[model samples]
Target: MNAIFLMLMGLGAMALGYFVYSKFICEKIFKVDPHFRTPAHEMQDGIDYVPTNKYILWGHHFTSVAGAAPIIGPAIAVIWGWVPAFLWVVFGTIFFAGVHDAGAIWASARNKAKSIGSLTGDIVGNRARSIFMIVIFLVLLMVNAVFAVVISGQLINFPSATLPVWGAIIVALIIGQLIYRKIIGLLLVTIIGVVALYAMIYAGPMIPLALPDSIAGFSARQSWIVILFAYAAIASLLPVWMLLQPRDYINGIQLFIGLILVYGAVLISGPEIVAPAFNNELPEGTPSMIPLLFVTIACGAISGFHGLVSSGTTSKQLDKEPDVRFVGYFGAVGEGSLALAAIIAATAGFASLADWQAIYHSFGQGGVSAFINGGANILQQGIGLDTVLAQTLLTVMVVLFAGTTMDTGLRLQRYIFQEWGHIYNVGWMQKAAPATFLAVGSCLLLAFGAGGDGAGGMLIWPLFGTTNQLLAGLTLLVITVMLVKKRRPMWYTLGPLIFLLVMTTLALLTQLKSFYDKGDWFLFTLDLVVLAAAILVSLECTATLTKQIKANKASPATDQP
Candidate 1:
């Protein structure tokens, strides 16, 4: 199929799913009544539950959903073939991701604006709440760790790129502080910030820094740990408006512009889809279809991480009625579309099947970073831009992307820790100081200990896929329970839930075996950690459902006549 045709098909499918499928489910079954005051409406605190304009909320939702995972997952999935990757992106977004995101938003809206963990407790059981917390905590840890590695790797490869990134970040911080906290004039600060960002990008190569010879030996992996811990510390200490919000705004704009340019170039250059629609030739013992493809492409289609963002951060900031579906549901569609674009770019323009394989083999091992840089080179050559400069620009862009995600992960981790403190009745530990310390300390220790050398090692690399997929599995389980509780049709939720459970379980087992065979004790230990958690979560979910069913049976009928 032609590029335009594919793009249209993918987008149309998502739109149809959103408007037709999502609307029917919400109206007929879940019966979301926007006119009815939500918890936020009843308790308008202006702090967390304040009503917000849909447009402003869109900014928040889109920024929260758009992160490093979309890029990484699709890029990696393309290793299987663009067909499987593309189909997953299309079908998963329509059937799975949209439902997951919409369900999370609606569920949150119905629950007095509570976090997903709290709702899981109310709808499922108290034990499920604890399991949800633990699962989300682990997921956040992996997010912070992997993104730390991602940013550090880019910075190491292109030191010059840091100038524009830091400049943009500082500008964003100032602007965010000004607008949200009214520390300064919003108009003046944003104008200055934008100008500074542009100048920094234009003059990026001119900046220089001296480094010791020892720095040359620094592992990208080790640098990730240091940078992550240090940033988490600062993020915890600072007000969200000053850093996180503004930073995300700047990063979001950058992401939008960069992606536009990328697709524009692809269109102008008329790059063809060079990879086969399907790679039916499987090597011995290879699993190309079904479970493997589904698990491998988890993020591109549906992700549990989106639920964390939706409930933890975005929902709290929601300001208006119409904003929920626009920000929450549409933003998810945008992210899925971005993944589709990346798959197209990666698979297009290669000379032959062998060339496609060569490109994939050469850059696929390093994950999204490798694929992004490689794809940038192709676009540059195809569109006649300077290869070196184009590659450098792409590198910086991705670093900024990863930085935004890590920032969110750090904040979420802090909140999770503080909540845990409250749950444990450690009132003294409920303050931001201890929570911030633990969050930052945990991230740094894991990042550093996962691989002392900055190279990120194999230990941290493989966990990205497994941890992310496991989170998706957990999310599906929770959503399924919510649907059952709401008396919605069980078939839709149950089908995907069961399918994802089996796929994720097998994927986890595969990862455990790979870890054991490689003799990587650290990853092996992580596998064990996730495995134990998975077992407990399964038991909790099953037990909770059983109780609910029995309770329903025992309840007396109101009037039999």
Candidate 2:
């Protein structure tokens, strides 16, 4: 099969999702009121709650939700064959991710921009909220810690990407100043930022830099991890408009360009689908593809993390209530498109079946590294760009996205800490500096304390997919309850909620056994905690649903905003 078929099919599905399906949900289901005052306007704090243009807010939401998971997940899951991964990315985005993301933002905005975790208290119950918040924190912890290791590894591996990756930050700072300070027009600044970014990409191969192993007595990777966390702490502390918004907005544009390069290359070259549609010959220890495939491709299809981002940060910045359809749903579409690109690059970028097999000899093999190498090859062959420069371009794309996500995740984690502070009546934890310190401190502990290497974040990575999907199911449950209370059609969110919960529960059971047998008691215990939380939250949501249904039956439907 030609890669163009997958490209056309995926892109076409997402277009219909945006144009047709999203319209139905936005108008009929969400009933987005144009006149509705959003938290961004109601609060109007310059720090985190400034009203933003839909486009810029969309950029921030998309990039923060994206991270490297979309790339990493599909890149690895293609091991099950591109057919399964491709199907999941396309239909999952249309049916699952789009609604979940858009619904999350709508739910949060309607409720005064509360994080999904906090919203659970009012809609579900305080008990459920406590459990839900823990799950959210664990997810954020996994994200911040793992992404730091991911970026560190990429920087160490692709030294050429180092300059462009860090240079983009400086470019973003200037763009933020220019845009927010009204120093220049959005168009000219966008043009300038992107040009500067690409110029750095072009110059990256000319001056590749690598740190020595003994930097501050830590290995280069460890040192990079420390540096990245430091940067994230600072970025999280800064005002969203000062760095987060502009950085993500520009990087979102850069990713679109990067996607065009790869997709355009596919159209021009028509690469063969070298990998099998279904792999009958499994790697020795590959898990069954049933539940694993769903979790492995979580971000591209549906992610609980998206709900956190939607409610945590994006909802607070929405300029209009109706923008949820675009910023929330389209953001999922954007990540799904990136996942599709990863699928194409991974399965089709190789020269032959045997060569692809060499790369996929293991389940976890062929992730970010595979995507970069294969994507660079496609660019070089199809567009005649220098392979080195192409690699730098793709590398910088991954690094910038992951870096932005880390910034957002850490910030969200800080919010979680402050929320906890309020719950426990701890004054210092509510402070920005102290909460940020706790967030960074916990991630650092997970990194250095658990695994001891710079890769400690990988310690809990195996559980991220299951835990994340479980949280997504719980988030949808919250949204479903809101819809039920409103007397709106909720089959869209409820169906995916049920599906995700089932798959995630099954996956958790499988992992529980796997961990127990391997004697990895630490992860086994953590898995148990997550599994228990999933069960508890599900019960609370069910109870809340029943109560809402009974109340609706007893009285006339009272519509809510």
Clash count, candidate 1? 10
Query: How much is the lDDT of residue 24 in candidate 2?
Result: 95
Q: What is the lDDT of residue 184 in candidate 1?
A: 67
lDDT: worst 10-residue window of model 1: 208-217
- What is the lDDT of every predicted structure here? 0.67, 0.94
Candidate 2 residues lying further than 4 Å off, grouped into runs, are none
CA error at residue 518 for candidate 2, angstroms: 1.4
Which residue runs does candidate 1 get wrong by more than 4 Å? Answer: 36-51, 181-199, 206-225, 280-290, 349-352, 362-366, 378-385, 455-461, 546-561
Best by TM-score: 2
Decoy 1 TM-score against native: 0.86
